[model samples]
Target chain A: MTSDAVSAGGDPRRLLADTRTFARRVRVAQRVTWLPLLVLGVVTFGAILVQAVSRPVTTGCRTTDAGEICKVWNPVLESYWLVAMVAAYVVIAGGYLRVARARGLGSRVRPYVIAGVAAAVLMFTLIAAGAGRWIVPDPHDLLNPSTSILVLFRLLTASGGIGLALLVLAWLERNVALLLFALGYLAVVLVPINFGWGSHWSGKSEGAAQLIVNGLVLLLAGAGFALAQRLRASR
Target chain B: MTGPVDTPAPESHPVTGLDDVVHQRVRLGILTIAHEARRVEFGFLRTELGLTGGNLSQHLAVLETAGLVGIEKGYEGKRGRTWISLTTAGDAALAAEIARLKQLIARVETTVPRQGEAS
Candidate 1:
């Protein structure tokens, strides 16, 4: 309270302790991770609807020394993803800026937004260049029991680059929880999961099931973080 | 071999290294928060330090005059807000102050006698 509280004869230990506590409080108060998590979750979940509505247009199939490479291009899906990803980044940036303005605190989310937008553009470019067809193969072969696991890694682009860009956000926020979630999410993106492999769940769309699961994971993490933030605020 | 080169001895005490502008408790808190946040609003600083508007304004003016902090006035939506950011000099001064504080604490611990000590 006093102007010269930390004068020469004063206790440096107390001042240092109080400063540390203040810094911790500021760090906690500025966190707004749940907004992006929830928004991305919804965007990812909506991918299933887009998948069902947009039919794949096959250009042609050719036989090569390596294998059969079919060019099945879906302009609808590509456009949807490009627009969705760019919009999501805009929404996230706006959300952070709004929160910062309201709370009178600054957020370090620009790097995350930039990385996300760049990743989305890159994914769209790669797909347009015929990378998706080469990696995914024929739709009929996708659900076959003998389908290669490598084929399923295509699901990593389910959220249109939002999945990998989360790592950038984790670094920006310096959030360990978010970093852990991002790593786990990356594993989910890379690993092909057949939810209805053996049970009554069979005959269902395997890709759709995987997307639903990914969306649920994001939603659940968002809810958990929101609750934790609430508890911290209440305390 | 040539004569040994002379090396200047360190300061008599770490207190000599302490910066007057940055040593006060409130000012140090302001600089610390600004350094961490990169840009902090004036209202947030006032609320966090539990200081009155006048007191916070006085401290900010001192910091601004010393060229240790930069002040920008802008509108956040319809409301006018003042933002404070630490300068390069401010950051360096804070680091130096912390180092001096650490040295001062270390000296006190080593030289000061504990309870029931012979000295």
Candidate 2:
């Protein structure tokens, strides 16, 4: 055979290497990348479950004031709500992953990461600005389902996005920009909602946890974008 | 005289450029389905995997993040639809993956041990 033909004779090790690399990427996305969220989801859900069983679900059954109502929800209703919350989380999380995957580990996530960071930073600033509190250290207003519902709706929109973004970080863990973007997305939703659900610092912690989540999201998004860009450029 | 120093040029990339190929079983499944059709739907993959929408979605996210598929959301009839397609890179990767796999199989088959002797 000519030297050209000999040069064209392929190497087997290259195929093995490619397979290993591809497998690693898939493995990262599927397993290693998802740990924190899985833990957070399980713990949060468990806490809520315990609370539902333990807490009265209503505060002022005997009081003569605007507190005469009992926490009237049965276990079944609570179960349904649990399922719903999970479903919503799953759906939102799915969106983040999708965006990440589409974007890959590179440029596409830049815009999203920027958007998320902007949102998170904006949220933190807003909270630091102290315009409002949705969930506070106080629960005198907790029974006010009307206001709670309003806050819940907002949480559904903003936090949902943050959660989705957090899930995206599997693909491009190398990008700190992605991590910032994830944090930003988290802050945008959580800073306000933390005022609704928990304490200021806890809200801050929510923001912090969001950083991790957002990191995941950015990685996933980066990977996705990288993959897509690579694919497109090839054609 | 030159005003300022410039960054050094980056090293050249690797040759036999299949590093970016999609080769996993599920990713291959994703590419195969996407390649065969104009667009593959989310629900379709769910049924194929016998997995809930959530699990399939996660996998799809992986495929998407890797740039092997393009997903377009729209409607078929009144309901929302998620349509996925292979990008050009994805197509190339798929083709490369196929050739690579074929090469691996050929290598193994030819190098098969004779009567249990390690070849």
Candidate 3:
């Protein structure tokens, strides 16, 4: 029978057209949602690399049971690195909010963005404060502080970092794998510090740890970009 | 020319198997967009579908009344915005509509003869 004889059936062409339109719309939306986070990840990796290279190292003093002791390098640069990393995070959060607004993601996302920014700021301030104490010591004691405050700040910093990471991850749903990689990176960094494992590292071991962590970060960033490219190409 | 060519009856055809509300072009577009996102903005839908504010609102109202979509109004910064999302019922309806469309396509493929065969 001629196809025209089946006129009572809906047009197959029309259904196909609708399906194509839906698919196209979804593809466009996914691209818009993910592109920003991907760019931010690359930029963050670059900033970290620059900070690592430019970081200044100098001999410093520590207070031990015997007397005032000298250490090979003061971690002053680490503070600066933390500041730069936090700044990058703030920028990413701000950019995400702008993109969401532009795409009409509604006002509901505003609170999450605000919370993310606040967490970034809190993390930065705590790290900077700890670094300041190291660089400019109090007259009575150069190395030690109230142990309670030290532990409190460390906990706060970890919480803030996790909070910001989660907010960014939620906004960048398309790059979920990358975001999880980032969270894993954070966990690797924070878990050791939380347990005070760094205190046991000798000077040489400290350097080795730093190198290993930095290498892992580079690997994660590189893998993230590659996966993002594969996803885009497939799309 | 051949006395209406004996068009297939409605009961015998698969077109009647489709849902009227979900099959509409604009409504279908709305459902498709909402399904992709956690929650979609009213402005986004209007821009994507190329519908006026009032036109989109009417369609949204119909969907809302039918328990297919939920509309939320809230403020972002200082400005008011409306968010649109598909209800559970809406998601199910959309899925069913898509399945029905696929079945129809398959039926057409099996029943319609190729051009070379006709010759």
Question: What are the TM-scores, per candidate, against the unseen true structure?
Answer: 0.79, 0.29, 0.47
Instruction: Report, for every candidate in turn, its global Cα lDDT versus the true structure.
Output: 0.77, 0.48, 0.59
Which residue pairs show backbone clashes in model 1?
A: none
Poorest lDDT segment (10 consecutive residues) of candidate 1 chain A: A197-206
Docking class of 2: incorrect
In candidate 1, residue B19 scores what lDDT?
A: 84
lDDT digits (tens) for residues A1-235 of candidate 2: 2223212134455444444544344323322223334433443344344444442233324443545433332333234334444453444345545643442311123333544444444443443333233344233444455655545534543344345445464333443444564565555544542323333443223334433443444445546555654664487
DockQ of each: 0.39, 0.03, 0.14
TM-score of chain A of each: 0.80, 0.27, 0.43
Q: Which ten residues in a row have the lowest lDDT in candidate 2 chain A?
A: A1-10
Residue A179 displacement (Å), model 3: 14
The better candidate by TM-score, 2 or 3, is 3
List runs of model 3 lying over 4 Å from the truth: A1-10, A30-98, A106-235, B1-13
Candidate 3's docking class is incorrect
Per candidate, native contacts kept equal 0.39, 0.03, 0.30
Off by over 4 Å in 1: A1-17, A59-61, A132-160, A197-206, B1-14, B74-80, B99-119
lDDT of 1 by residue, A109-138 (tens): 788899888888888877667675555556
lDDT of 3 at A23: 50
List clash counts for every candidate, in order. 0, 45, 0
- Whole-model lDDT, candidate 2? 0.48
- In model 3, what is the error at residue A163, expressed in angstroms? 21
